[model samples]
Target: GYTVHTVLEYNYVLAVEVNGSVVGYVQTEQVFDSAREEVAQRINYAGAGEESWTVEPSYQIAVGEQVLNENQMADAILESSSSEIQSATGLYVNGELVAVTTEGDRLRQELDNMLAPYQNPDDPNLTVAFNKEVRCEDSIYFTSTLVPVDEIIGKLHGEEQGAVYYTIQSGDTPWTVAGSFGISVDELQAQNPDYDFNSNSGFPVGSQLTISQAMPYLQVKRTLVSTYQETIPYETEEQQDSTLPMGTVQVVQEGAEGLAEITQQQVFYGDSSTPSETTIIDRVVVQEPVKRIVAMGQYVPAENIAYLSDGSTLIWPVPAYRGISRWMLGAGGKIHGGVDIRANYGTEILASASGQVTVAGYHWSYGNYVVINHGNGYQTLYAHASSLAVRAGQTVAQGQVIAYVGSTGKSSGNHCHFEIRLNGARQQPRDFFPNK
Candidate 1:
């Protein structure tokens, strides 16, 4: 008769195979039901397939009756088969599952031991014990380490743990000092609320103030005040019938003071006068000390003044004119804007004053023209020119050749139109010339 020998474990059967065919089998009940259920649940969660089952009755066993021979039937009894049970353990940290191993139970025990030191037995706030290892696919695996919530939150806020300090100085107003240091006055005041600007002055001569550094002020080349002076020969005619030789008077002193000082002096014979031996008449300073001093001021610093003529202050807009255009008051019948000298066609035009070339190209009716801005709102314009020699912004000296005269614009014949402007408004050029 076939009969069950012994029980092995839950969901497992054990059977003994004999030499030929007949075998005996037994069933086993698991002792750790909770652990087995956990493993089963993990396997189900892993989506593993179910195991196949087989059932067979011994041939010697009668239908629904007991075996007749006990020893012979024992050899023929059905063998109890047991599927190979494997223990799998996997570790998880921060909800991430890790590797599995053959020694699943040992790995699980090791993980449990490692977590035991950090475990808080009395911590009621902890809802679940940290799972270090878990059983998976008949093996043990590990999980990523978990960080404390408080630690993560602390990193997010960025807490400071260092000390900061600032120094105060004399002559230091809260606003200015704070600005120099690149910090706000409010911030400085907040840092040192007791700081008093009146009582605690910043700039104690050599005292250092701990503030942010700043770029130093730049030093630039600037023109001081500019001055100009021109000396011209003055003659006084004496009407006499005496038999005395016409004596020539030579200037012994050329005087200029302040901004323009007389560096040297030279005496020359006049065009119509001849040198005659004469007794010492009298040596005296005719003109008082003409002082022209230029001081550098904040507004309109002194710059190099342009000259129109070489060694002379007489400046003409065009190098030449045509048909003897006389100096008249205005334009035509108006005040004399400028002296119109006579010249033929293609006469070299010259700059009247030393200045920057402000207008050197052409105008609507003036034709090819040149306008020079002599600082201090003084300017000179040349018109009716055939060609321009200097460009705008070019520096020019008095009497410098700048163009050629011709009947280019609004001119009845070949001639040059000259005008002077003070502060962008037209002014009479005769006002600047010495009384002939």
Candidate 2:
């Protein structure tokens, strides 16, 4: 309708037009369009009538052949890209995912409700857990479905659950067995009440042990008290009694055994027989021990008395020429009243000369013996005798058997204790004997 012509502006060629007889540029090549063309294009794209076109600019603008504004273009570009989003609940067992659900919080709440009855009410920190591995975790994925909490709970408590059994071996303790089964020692002990752990031979070999990892996954602790009673041996007590004969011993009172009681306290976890902790609570003697009593004799008799002098010579105490075992004075300067003649245990003791038995009884250091009175200033003494053949007031001649040689009283060995007494005083017997 209107004539258009080209005009040169610097390097761009412009299209000119005459509108209402006013010359105006219609467009500049690769640069911009005239105001009339821009407004008209906007009006056409918005489908506005001439009346609205005069009132205001359109909400949309056209760029090239596409009909998109700045805000609309940005929205379209953003919509073209995509990302993965996962929102669901997951059931993880032993760190492995086993199931998933859309409603994670709901499933967890339901599981808690189901497990509430089995939870340890007394322990606020304790919670119910599945016998097997099971837990909920948040996961990322595209899509997932919700699983019923009841179904999962059924699987936890149902017969499909696994069980563990252990055969007791030598040197195996409940603690070790439970550890192998992935359980606590107390748990192992609580289930096997019949097994005796007090003895050294614990849980006999080849015995079968049941490990409890069952439903209502809760651990129970128990206190086990063990009592040990044993006999304490009584000690022998030797009591020296001077009244008893030197060669004799008698038991005054019999010794009795005593009893010792030991009490122990132990703590165990769950059905376990093994104790996690053990302590000795009490150890005492229930009955005191009665010591054995033995009585010994210590009595000395007076030497024989001689008044008149007699021409009686001494003879050998034993038949053979037995050498003297000890002298009157011992190695430590201890005074020995009689000579020890080396003789066998039951050797005969002969009377040195014609004499009468003056004293016959147990002597403190003389053991068992008899003293002979020769009726002279000289008197021979025969001590440390096993048996007294002649009694007091009995007469005996020379070479007559009066007693037997023995290791009695304080005698160290079997020997004849011989000595010559002058007026009841000790003297060397060898001095009186021609060949002692």
Candidate 3:
């Protein structure tokens, strides 16, 4: 219902006839004026002669032509909408064009397969679906285009703008970078072949790494109404006791962990790379926690361990182990006043010098620890012990087994935390040991 005009040659196309003789042609209006003026001069030169001109129409497609309307301009070329013309299946994610594949059955199968991993065989209440509504649309294509199934899937999983390079910055580890870009480490290594992923060393800063992945356009969302038991941590309570000695604590009751029944909705998106998130629907405590009760002593009793001058010097607490993982003081005067001696688990921890056990109990920083006072305003503390061989107010001879080494409290591994305090002040123990 509209007139479609096309220009073959836009420059000049006008036929000029002077006295029935074909002269030349001009296309523009200004050029036509000049040709007319020449024709008039020729007419004047030859009296009784007539001059006429006719516009020549050309119908050719070129840069000067305006054929397709604004609506059809996006196609760049007009497509046939006849009954004989057919289009393939188009995959769309949340109404966006994901891909167009020739095999509709295969595309639909692939979409169904994505949801298979999210299905729970045991849970009837589990609902698995696409996080973004995805569909293999039939015959929605306005153009004659068909992509291979593999290519369609690749494009569907790739970034909309294709591959890009990301500059590695400070604190940009492989895990953090991959998570930020929604890519996996294997995908990262696929592009960077030179990187040794097995090594623990980090990549250098100011380097460029290729990032070429996106979360699959269609994400399988799994929602399950689940019920599970949760743990309730016990609380610690301390009471004052005047009958016991100072720097000593006695446990009144042992603590026990409690349980709670929680009903929640577990929502997981995509594969195991992404963890399931929980939303508590209902919660009820099955068993209440029993608080840990300990009695803190206020009095230092008149009774004390008798002193003997048989041994006066300090002895290596952990025998057969000479590995000192850390020192008491570092360069530039960074002082922690304690040393970490690495040893096997359950290794004997001997008393450095003869003294009375002042503390043989649990501490927040030093678990199952022991502290001995050696009468001359000097004391020694052995922390992170597996078990105590001596208790508070008990006497231990020099080099006697007082405890066993263990990785407890805030320790990283099996190590003995040793420290010496002079009148309640911590001192450097580097010079106190016999070995250099």
Best by lDDT: 3
lDDT of 1 by residue, 277-351 (tens): 223322334354443322211111112122333333444343223444665474543544555655677777766
lDDT of each: 0.46, 0.60, 0.66
Per-residue lDDT tens digits for candidate 3, residues 159-271, read: 44545789888877888888888989888888788876668654667888888744454567888787899999999998888786543468999999999999988788766
lDDT of 1 at 190: 56
lDDT of 2 by residue, 1-436 (tens): 2333322223332332222121222123322222334333322332423324231211222122323333232222222211222445567656444555676776678666655654556764343454445677553322323456566655544554346677898788877788888888777777777776656665889998879644343233455567889898989876767665333458999999999998887776545568778898898999988998877533212221112335435656665436777667644324787677888777777776778888877888888877888877667777888888888999987666788888778788888788777777787554444344
Q: Is candidate 2 or candidate 3 better by TM-score?
A: 3
> Which rank order by TM-score, best down to worst?
3, 2, 1
TM-scores, one per candidate = 0.27, 0.28, 0.36
Model 2 worst lDDT run, 10 consecutive residues: 55-64
- At residue 28, candidate 1 shows an lDDT of 25
Candidate 2, which segments miss by more than 4 Å at Cα? 1-310, 330-334
- Lowest lDDT block of 10, candidate 1: 215-224
- Judged by whole-model lDDT over C-alpha atoms, candidate 3 comes out at 0.66
Write down the RMSD of all candidates, one decimal each.
36.5, 29.5, 21.2
Clashes of 2: 18
